[model samples]
Target: MFSHIQKIHFVGIGGIGMSGIAEVLLTLGYKVSGSDAQKTTITRRLRRRGAKVYYGHQRENLKNPHVVVYSSAIAPSNPEIVEARRLDIPLVARAEMLAELMRLKYGIAIAGTHGKTTVTSLIANILTQGGLDPTFVVGGKVKSLRTNARLGKGDFLVAEADESDRSFMHLSPTIAVVTNIDPEHMEHYRDYDELKNIFKEFCLKIPFYGVAVLCVDHPAVAAIAASFPKRFLTYGIHTKADFMAHKIKLYPFKSSFELKINGKSAGQWRINLMGSHHIQNALAAIAVGNELGIPLSSIKKGLSQFKGIGRRLEPLYKNEHQKIYVIDDYGHHPVEIRETLNAIRQTWPQARLIVIFQPHRYTRTKALFSDFTKIFDGTNELFITQIYAAGEPPIHGVSAKKLADNIHSNSFNVHYRENLNDVVHDVRGLVKKNTIVVTFGAGDVNKVGKQLSKMMKEMPLQ
Candidate 1:
């Protein structure tokens, strides 16, 4: 705790990562203030926590702060950032602030192209169950905890390392985890090699006394373990690893697995989540908790109690009366979409699946277009919405319509709608009994899920 740093401002505070950090600072008795263009639940919660919240950015919003924190998504020209610089206030990248927090505690940072949020939340939940009272800043709302962050008294500090801009390198955690590496966030890196090398460097940042947990299931991630620079543990079902999970059983909203430590029986674990991927996330949590000397019983209990993170295959509405289910997820990347859909298929194999996918960033869409096109094979229907800019100027030839057109999945009906509301309207007619509709993206696409669920639920129960 920096006694001298009382007042801190965040430029893009509504972001999941930035909001969690701001909440932690607030709980630490700091005067927190921030601004974002959208008035969201996150901003409102910050205001309720006594942080000064501004709906829009302006120079006036930067009123005399000791330091300023900005997320990777914030533009350099943001008025609050510009004003803070002009006023000679310290400007800290969100990751830099996270690193500072990690420095003060027994850091357990989860980094990777995918499942960072889930893995971070998993470790935090497990440690909490172990009575460690860890401070954690998750990138999404933890459904069981009801908040993305907390300032606990324990030494362990759990958090997600944002690798979008190679910013995760700022963190040197006591324990590090990389869930998996994919070709993502290419807009910020020079090339794929740089991305992989950066992850390698992140694992190397582990202190000699620290542990780095990685999933060797991903070939790229497995390649990083060769001659790795630190004490590291590998977890997966496919490849031979230090930690492995087998006897996997995935239900609609739950999964069970048996763990083995270097071919020795550990214990059976259950997660209140779907997919073998989630089981893999739980493996990382198990590895870290065991390294920290937490009891295997405690680790098993935590994994069993993992309710899940917000917007991560979160069920919005399940009308038992009509049998229509709506799920909302922050699945923007191709790998995420593929895994989630596959999980849904295995969970509700007989249910018709309809997906409303809003492409997140133009750069991501352009970079992963071919991958995106091939992921909708089993979908009953696919609705592509206009790209959510996230402040990125539109890149030529990277529209959602183009993706829709290129998605020549004969097995599924694909359509593109430029308007979100129109997509919602169309979805109303698509959902019926035994249908599972998912809103997929890292943007405001959840709005469609919410609206569709509401409209569909209010209809007559025939």
Candidate 2:
């Protein structure tokens, strides 16, 4: 699709979404260059793959590029972007580039507010195991592949459709999967209805011969499916749909369930993933696999063998000596946090569930404050830090301390730590036998979990 474009430069190349596309273009033998505010592993990996990487944006960074791609996080005022526009270089949004890549293959785009990464990773795993060798791009690093993007020799291309900026509308996938829709990214939409309508439009993008896969368990998703005019299939735990999972058994680190496809029992399935949320994610992958004519045995094996993606209930360290377990998760939304805590409780019924949470964005925290207060029911103890503003200006009257105070008023064990260092120290002193310390949020909260784990490892045996 980008045959005439010889050189491509990305504005925010370190971002997970942007880096993936950069890697794919590099693999395709395109001259790739990009700039980010900071250096990260993703950027380093891209540089190693023969792409020129810059630590920060500059007008000079846009030199001799046929097209410039900028991520949603980048602003129009960025120096590189300004230079590109001034020079009349073709500037494209990251989603536009991703859509162009999809245009060259049978695209399978996974869209939703949550579970998109997991479902995309699961589908990629299933396709790889089935000998499809589909090219895939996911938001998070897949533990099995150790990377977020790969270029394969197959005709299928699997990708995660980002809805935060409503850029997912740019993608017209041959096979589309909507895991679930929730009230998120309110900054971009007027209300929940508008968000739901956008999801409907995304589903309608599928061609006449293609199909849309949706989760019927979510009431919002189910309601949208009713009005969908094109071919679609539903999967869920509570609803009787085209694909379903039943008799689910949740364990500490794994779950198993019976799978059914179109009212017929496919077989039993198991995954090394925890929680009902993850089970639903696997069910969506099952739907895609079934539609692609992959054998049930291969699907089962792929799901069962799947290790997991980074920052999704990933266990960082387990100290048998101190009986402390450290886990990190990238769940900033109230529903995601609630489900993650529920999973932790179901897995370790006897352990004290201590949560160290860093609220992601001030706007999100302000928008979902009420929901956050009630979602920590399973949390035995809560420690919150200052908000991690993902490039947005701090919204007045919205602070993590305020959230901690409100949650504390609800009679739950809540504490407010000013920073990650304080959290690490507090956790070091509070951790006792059978304590499950889970760092929660989409920001740098995982760093606290890693530090706590390192501290636990250095403690004297006792």
Candidate 3:
């Protein structure tokens, strides 16, 4: 489909996934122009790389692009889309363009509700170490890549196939990594079964020669395995699978595990990242390595060198004298929140856990408020920030304050802060000597963590 495309324009150019594709196209010598609702670091980086970027969507910005690609977030009434239709320029959803790009190479898509960013980063790291020079586009930043996307000459194209907006079904992947699927994005999907059907369709999109690597630990994931035409490769910590982690060891700052596959002992791989979820991510990467016939030692080496994906258990600072640590994560979903809190609990059981959570969207907050409340059971203290409206207008009865009130825990003292500065002050006052502050959310909540880290670093030792 992209064969006819020379000059391309992106409607949501600042999005991490969209920027990745735009960068790849630019590296391939295509003229790329795009307009975002606002400027971001990603957009600025694209500009540095010679892509024409406009600040806002306007009909005038759609001039002379052969093909126009847009994220699902772009409304149909967007000025660029309206202009594209009026000018008769070929239009495609971001997923369609992604699928077209995948068809030109050996595409490996990592799909899941949670863990897609980390898994893609792990596989990309392993591929990089194995001399594959693979190109990749993850939804989050990778510490290894120093960017969200990379342009490489190797035939491997690794991307996080997002299930949101039903975009995962568009790609025809050679190897698909299904991390785990849970009911999410209730706004788009009618029900749980509806979401499962979408995932089943995504699996069916894989060609006959393709392999689907599934997490058997999740019944939902395992149930969709049979939907694929090709035989599926399974991995997990529980139940017998093709790739499994055993003898797991998790420390305050890192984790180690022994990987086994096909009844043969693969070397033990250690990761510098935190969380048991990361160990599972490494298992998925090992499965990919085994599939591609990469040496176990190379896989282990790559995994050991892996730091982490940004905003996913990303450590920001540590002050020994103050006895405090700050971490940030993009875990807006309930399941992600649960896993992250649990991981931190295991890693730092002695430290007082203080979570600063910013609800991402009104729909998600409404749909999973109960689950969100229950997640705090594992944390000692919680601070709720105002909802990060990611273009979603606030619902009548739903807000972060309501969520804070509903969540019940013995040690959980929840407070609401509407402004970032107030939230920072509240957190600083709440944090004690032995505190591990974790900022959780998919939106600007990251800034909370960043600001806290800066404050901690600048504060005089006492």
The lDDT per prediction is 0.88, 0.90, 0.86
Candidate whose TM-score is highest: 2
Candidate 3 at 69: error in angstroms?
Answer: 1.1
Ranking by TM-score: 2, 1, 3
Model 2 agreement with the true structure over 324-414: per-residue lDDT tens digits: 7899999999889888998888888888778999999888999999999788886778898999998889988999999988885444589
Model 2 accuracy (lDDT, Cα): 0.90
TM-score of 1: 0.97
TM-score of each: 0.97, 0.97, 0.96
Candidate whose lDDT is highest: 2
Model 2 segments more than 4 A misplaced: 320-323, 409-411
Residue-pair clashes per candidate, as listed? 0, 0, 0
lDDT of candidate 1 over 101-132, digit per residue (tens): 88889899899888999998888888999999
